[model samples]
Target: SKLWGACRNPWDTDRTPGGSSGGSGAAVAAGIVPMAGANDGGGSIRIPAAYNGLFGLKPSRGRISSGPSVGEAWTGASIDHVVTRTVRDSAAMLDVLAGPAVGDPFTIAPPAAPYAKLMQRAPRSLKIGVFTSSPYETEVARECVDAVEETARTLENLGHRVEYARPEFDGMALARCYLGLYFGEVSTLMDRAKTEFGARDDDFELDTRLIGMLGRTMPLPDYVRRRQQWNDFARALGAFFEGYDMYLCPTAGQLPAKIGELDTPSHLQMAARLMLLLKAGKLVHRSGQVDQMAMESLARTPFTQLANLTGTPAMSVPLAWTAAGLPVGVQFGAPHGDEGTLLQLAAQLEEANPWFGRYELLEAMI
Candidate 1:
């Protein structure tokens, strides 16, 4: 079968929509569905949502099922979620999707009532910490900074006390650690493909081939070191949450980039299209730079990834938009088994702002 060239952004026809869940985010933003399914191994859902002006929640790992198909994806880094225009849509989908499959390696217990029900209630006033810096080495866009500041104002209007806060630990080190693990995982997948499916060098894109070659050369100590980094990052986040109910941040560092802005096809033509895709993955995984659509996915998972690693619940709310009219999301997260509080707070914000169910572009698409 012929592969679709690439998914195009609904907002800008010339741009590439995000992936591997780009279609979901685009469909939701276009209003084809109230919300659409998404999964994040490394910012897949949140990136697209950020690009398309929708809310994307990648709940705690194992909080939703990945069963009757495969056990764990990307060595447990991947989690199921949805991209939506409203907070309640995300809450409602969580109600439907958050559960475990029989014989699963890990599963979070279900919430007491459907998340939809909880969204109807108000939450008590809470302290929120805002962090605007990119966890990675790259620079964040000014629009993203402005969006977060606006979110702070919005939260204040909702009666929540807000303050600028930074994580106590080193952001750069955290970025390095995440990259190590991420690359290591990519390496592992490539190795498996070769061994299990007898995949040849030509079967993969250039980047995949490079990753597989690197994986073959990685020492056992490298794996152990990456695991240690995960542990350290998890501990830092746990400590950070002790003083704040939720942490707010940009889903992406910048606005969505135009499709193919990352590279021209001529530059990528040195390698096959498969290689181009692999190169794209490497670019996103290594540099954390993505097109507007790609950034939505790229920037989201780092903050959310810790939640998955630590078994905490987190959500992104479509609370603000850029001056150019692109949607901007504010993320809120809680400790493990704390979806109740998270949803309650989101619901409260929804009531206070009443921004839910307000995607005009999406409605037009239908």
Candidate 2:
């Protein structure tokens, strides 16, 4: 919070640009700079890209080394990339930053040619699956769903085969597994806070404190089981991709969140709310109300996690706008080593429907 103090959406200052990388999102959207650094451990990159009307891609795991200082992040669930206004910018940056550092644990093969140059022409006809369902069965906003449908039409017009399909998995179980890993990371940060900053419960957000408590008390075997679930989910998606080059979905289940709508409560305030739930016997993790709240919070982002879990390459392309004049993006995910396909498609889409014109309008308004 101290870093930027609630970075707001340029389109509407009363709305958020989206998370962890929201600062980058806001800067790019407002034309403060052409591109900015971003990273995605979950939907950190794509979420912001969707909210701010930019292009953001998460490359295959190990495509960009996270070495010298650290080998992997979030147990390899995270990767570094950038949010960009142009697909070519992202591709050029990838060409610059991608490679294995000495003694790195693993590495992905380098691109056949510089990505910036590769975008010079359209890609060959490919098979694309149009998937719109939220894994959590949460209600996706109409605008978000419409964005996927519109993108599918545009891709088909670009000579790619499009079909309706989705990977099979238990949404609730995957959420549990992901939350377990996330909580473990939070617990680690808590340790750092105590040691370095002398921080305590009062210093954390309500959600962070509660999640940390759960992580501290969680059994070791349970954590292991959650990781195992990650492997299982990855395998399932791998098989599902056998007949398709990529799966297209909404970047978010909803539009950008209004300011203060998704704000984090201070620990003390949250503790009071927790007591009320506890009194009603609804504080347990398995409680229906608790589960509903968790789902709701994640509802806008249920589609982005599968790619992160599988270490696949995925991208958010700014392809549509809502009646309220907000941007909503479509996400395209390819198999673990097929980032080139996503880049090529994004370039083609850029040519078909340029967004710089919209960026110019935003500049005039601001």
Candidate 3:
């Protein structure tokens, strides 16, 4: 995507496959492979699955090793697994990747049975809290709302106790913290590029440069404070899980955007260019523009970050599609280290509403 342009969805070229795992989603959806590797920091795996109509799961923190060198990614908000058309493939992949690396910082208990075995059957009588609104209080599209409602109905019919609810937390605050991670990661990586590769300011794209600049201007104490706030969110979600077996919401706040629709608009681009030219990163940060950037960049992606932030297992189950034939997915989040529950539920949904063969039908039409 850096140079080749956006990866278009195989089902409809006008729409994206979602990112940054969108390429893997596209490759799997277009039948290039049965499965491909993916990860989620803030919905990377689930976003692509929602757009491309696949089963994607983000394992709980430390369920899979982050690295042999660095202990974590995105401050433990990210973990790697796979995206697949069938739930079983994801479960099988998890079994393969589930273990402690030699120098891992976090260690999670392994599943009692392998996930492939766990996901083959449904978890009984799940009390799922369902919501369709954005945590950031932004608008969720009508179709996205409808997808969750429909799935809620289907879940109810399947004898699961479905209720309208969400975990208690400051959505905007969480957004700020998430963006803070972005700033720090971008800035640190930019410096690494300069040190490791002799990269210049002009070498990066405008958005990357802007985020990196914000990172450079960010205060270390503020970064530490924001990281600490993640605990509050984790506790809130933990409290919610006391009553709810899992949480259900739209995987994305809206359907996939038309390519380039999310790009910084011309006026903003001009403003950003001016800031970069003048090295006015702190000024922009003080102007409360970061909030605007969060809304612009993350409004559509608010749902999946809770799992990432809380180090819980979550999945996007492809149970709905729009009238235009674009896929929309419903998310299911389980308690920490409870990927087996999410996977089992996903397999149940897959059985009740089969989506695996739709691509073959699309191929026929094409």
Candidate 4:
């Protein structure tokens, strides 16, 4: 374990920065990079980006290449993207990374123009929908809600029509269905690992081991049923988006947890804690479910998971800061393959708000 030294939290050495992308978030937030690479199966990019005050975009499922390694990550749900400080920077990164590689299962069509170039243009006035609560009935933190409201104001000021609305779908049912698909992938991956390396539970972290165990118990029929649920959820979102160009919400139910709050030697314990936090957030409408002692150890990343499930394009823009001086980001999503509109609007907001980028953080770090 000491081979990599302790994965110290850049914010506070006593804690961890969250994983499996913790290092990327910590490094970016600490001013090591203006943007860093991140992948999200379940909120890896957005969570770290939110924690580090960077912009994170998990584009539509096939938008970016996952090739030169595997055809899909986490059963085609995961994607590669970048976390950055400015919205334009993320858009630019997408231009660089958005495309399927050789042997890809499916490819997302390229944009009409380079996304980076598109940002220099103007975005037309568009309708924006805002929701503060999680689709699964999760309570969002006041800070998160405040950030979304502020973003709404920003959007309105920039000439977009904004309205308060909630999707008609049930978030809890969708979450359960999504979880089944996610766990099924976990099981598949574990089986492959076991076959390849003769590895067992001891080879992975507590959470990974638990995933493996759960994968073993999932029947094929359960997997099929879950896929159907995913389809239903996606169709609901498709209909919801037809009425609006974009949906705005908090990237996470709450702010970043302190580091080291979710660390555990037992994978099952960690997995249980994660599920508990998700369920608690859904039930309570906020993210204080994890013990205060462990909140810093575990990362909270529920709000970003929806985009992953639906294969939609989502971005987290850091536009506000908490009283405690932590950055708060508002997330927005567009329909699959419709990143043009999202980037256009992001560029408009960047021009209006002009969030400090590398220079500001560099000055602070110095």
Q: What is the TM-score of each candidate against the true structure?
A: 0.82, 0.93, 0.98, 0.84
Give the per-residue Cα lDDT of candidate 2 at 363. 94
Compose the digit string of candidate 4's lDDT tens values, residues 252-359: 777666444444546747656675445432332234322231222222455666777778888877777778666777888889998888878877877777767533
lDDT of 3 by residue, 30-131 (tens): 888999999899999999999998889999999999888669988798889999999999999999999999989969888889999998877888899999
Candidate 4 Cα outliers beyond 4 Å, as residue runs: 1-19, 198-200, 264-299, 357-366
Error of 3 at 48 (Å): 0.2
Using TM-score as the measure, the top candidate is 3
Q: After superposing candidate 3, which stretches have Cα over 4 Å from the reference?
A: none
**lDDT by candidate, in order shown:** 0.68, 0.84, 0.90, 0.71
RMSD of 1: 5.0
TM-score of model 2 vs. true structure: 0.93
Top-lDDT structure, candidate number: 3
Q: What are the per-residue Cα lDDT tens digits for candidate 2 across 160-182?
A: 99999888888887777777788
Worst 10 residues of 3 by lDDT: 357-366
> What lDDT score is found at residue 249 in candidate 4?
85
- TM match of model 1 to true structure: 0.82
Better of 3 and 4 by lDDT: 3
Q: State the displacement of the C-alpha of residue 180, model 2, in Å, after optimal TM-score superposition.
A: 0.8
RMSD of 4: 5.9
